[model samples]
Target chain A: MIEALFAAVLGGLLLLGLHRKVIARVQQRPGPPVWQEVLHTLKFSFKSTWVPETASPGLFVGIVLVAIGIWTAALAVVLAGGSILIIFGVYMLHKIVEHGFGLSSGSPYGKFGAVRSVISAASEIPLFVSVAAIAVFTGSLAISDIVAYQAVNGPLLIIAPPAAFAMYLVILSKMPFSPFAIVEGKELVSGYKTEHFGVWRAGLEVANAIKTSVLLGLFLLLFLGPLSPFAFVVAIVILLVSLSFVCAVTPMLAPFDSVTIQALVTVVMLGYLVLLGVIP
Target chain B: MSSLGGAPWYILEFGDELVYFTPYTTTLLILALVFTVLALVSRPERQVEALFGTDAIYAKDTTVDQMRFRRFMAIACGCASMGAVVTGDLFNFTLFVALVGITNVGIVAAVKNRHVQNAAFQYGLVALTATVPLFAGAGIVAATTGTLSIVALASGTVPQAPFFARALLCLGVVGEGMAPFYAAKAEMFRAPGAPYVIMCSLSSLLIFLRVAEVVMVI
Candidate 1:
């Protein structure tokens, strides 16, 4: 629990710092301070909300608590010790519930956002099924069991390249960059977040910071399983460097087109893993 | 207990164990790859007709789609409901229920409209009234069984409570479910479409609860 909490907090802050620096470098400007996100969150948390008369009076305070509660719960479930099936179910529940939030609101943007969420989630089904495949081969859903399986033979990445590639796509889609950002973008005033202000908005920012750290941690766990906790950090740095290189070399693809790209990549990777005898 | 997808092709067939077949594995991998490609290729196109549809209602906000707060409420409620599934004891489930209840209350309170307000008050009353009976019955069951556990109930090891707790729990679930639906029914509700959000969230929570019950049983 401590390890997950520590990772969530520290890793989140670091990623927040890195995200800004990278954007700044891209734009060739000094950019806001690395801690700008933290400051912004703090400011929002303290600001009072002017609840619109049209808005449910109860919502004046409820949304923030709900957002924070769900995000923290998701983070905890991922980090908790359990069977893979249970954890997977928990993750699915989180995604579905997020869609529900988009719909319950009376706003059109919220409804549209929910539609995008549905499509994004549908895309995740294949990725999750692949993860389930690994569990079938390994005979356990525990993360430790998965790590042990890779360590005993070789990393699953060597045998399940297709799975790895699919996971990479999930990482991008969930983080919501260029293409998938349609659901929650600035043009939509942060989509589902439009009516929210003060503490409620801050909940989202904190949830995002924590989520990034969790994603980075998962990346390290998948690619560098044999390493110790400290070593995982080193492995992540190397992976980030590689991701940055790829990011620079590749042109951005549209979200709709990503489906075909991912499919082809999966086919090739599966063949390679099978030929290499990485998957038994 | 395990069956392949609409076919008898076995992936890992054993007396007690069920696993995926190589063919099934390959299929999953291919599907993931396809989704990735589709995600990459389908950029939102800007057609004048698509943006400004012939209909007057959705003509505005055509430039970019948005998600609504109601949908998020449904999601949060679903999450809390799922959280209830992972707990090992009745107390924990109650706590989760309370958390979900508070979340629903919060969403209902935050949104505006007489319908929402009425729904929220009704939900609040039902929820509050039910919790008391739920606790009383649970307390009686504990007194009779000498142990209070969710698993015990699932296993049929604990003495049955005064039917009141089960009824209360069911009612609470209904009230919780309605909070999102009523909010979406309102006209002023903007952003993410309401009906879709309600459907997804309600269904997800229902499944989540069933899974959690199964876990308790086993």
Candidate 2:
């Protein structure tokens, strides 16, 4: 367990550095330094938190902590080989907490962002199911078992290619790439993160970087399986390349009605049957 | 789990192959793609694209957020289903499926779109119809194929299900297919659609009841 946690933290740092470089390359401009995320976090920690007068100060402080806590918990759960069920539940809790904080801001944009966050939370269900199906096939909820299953079964992904693709889509949404980048997709002038500035803003950015890494980790576990330390590093590079390609080609999506989310999931569920012939 | 070894977790002994889940996954992936396409199609309706393409990116604000939330919820529901698939515990699978069905309805209700009320209601009714087929099919498949163990089915240890289970499953699927068009009806009514929201909530409860009936039996 300790080993897994160590790997996750180390991998997370690397992901942050990789993210900066990827952003720089995509914009065709010089970006922040690779270790910028770490420096920003340290600076934010030392600064005083400025609570908005109308905001729920108690909730405000709690919200930032909740975001950090959830991200950390996700790291822990995925590392400890906890059941996918527990991991997902914790993820949902983190999302809800973040949304609650947004709503508590009392700004119209904040409130709007909060509602949007709720919508995003709802969309995560199908993604969760796709992972669960892999667990079911692998016959273990543990992340380690998933890796082991791949080692033994020659990778369940080849057998369940459609599910893998679906998982990729889920990751895309979770990662907030273009099109599905619903929450904080610049429409609300940064969506839920709008009111935040200074240290709080930095925290939000760091948290987002953490989220991006987590999603990548999930994608690797589900599709790529167990890898040597070297392979893992290579996979990270490949993932960034793909994400950049997605960024370059696809644009962000417009916010339609929330019901469209349900329809989208239903369609995905249907596709799972048509393409994979998997009937869970 | 204990039957497979200390490595019980490593054995995917369930009768079904990994391929069984493909349909659902494909459905989600393709739908997401279709949605992106639709949004692109809608872009011409507005005036002027921005330099950052912000307008194109953040198109239908409410729908995008809601879809993201749905994906998260699906993960939870699917996790529960994994329990069912691994253990061949139809009861467990049913429970998780029910939870998802109910929650989905609740979300629709929460939206409270009047224009989509009838649609939501009809869609809810269709989902409810699946419960019966699911039960009937399971029973028939069990009787004819003479294999009652869900674990066996999942692991591919058993032959195909009997006619009944398959028939019911098909029927349930057919019923579920009718959900969408009517679902958006409530969304059309008010500025944002209140009736659809009420209906969605009502259906959530209804789905719970329906899923409960089948899952309890398994």
DockQ for all candidate structures vs. native: 0.05, 0.05
Model 2 reproduced share of reference interface contacts: 0.00
What are the chain A TM-scores of the candidates, in order? 0.77, 0.83
Q: Which candidate is the best by lDDT?
A: 2
Candidate 1 ranges beyond 4 A from true positions: A2-7, A26-30, A56-66, A100-107, A176-178, A240-280, B1-196, B201-218
TM per candidate: 0.54, 0.58
lDDT of 2 at B2: 18
lDDT of 2 by residue, A140-235 (tens): 556777878888777666877756766666565655444566776776777667666667766665556566667677677767788887887788
RMSD of 2: 11.8
lDDT of 1 by residue, B1-218 (tens): 12111122444433322332222222222322222222122221111113354464322221222223444554565556544543435555555566666555554454444765675576566566656654554455566566555444544665654444554444454444432223332322232223322333433344334322332232
- lDDT per residue, candidate 1, A1-280, as tens digits? 6676656765676666655555556657686777777787789989996653333233324434444544465466456523334334434444544543454344556555544544444344444435545644565545666777878878777766566666666565555333444557555556656656687667767766666666666655554466776787777665554444344334445434554454455556545545545343
TM-score of chain A, model number 1: 0.77
Residue B76, candidate 2: alpha-carbon lDDT: 40
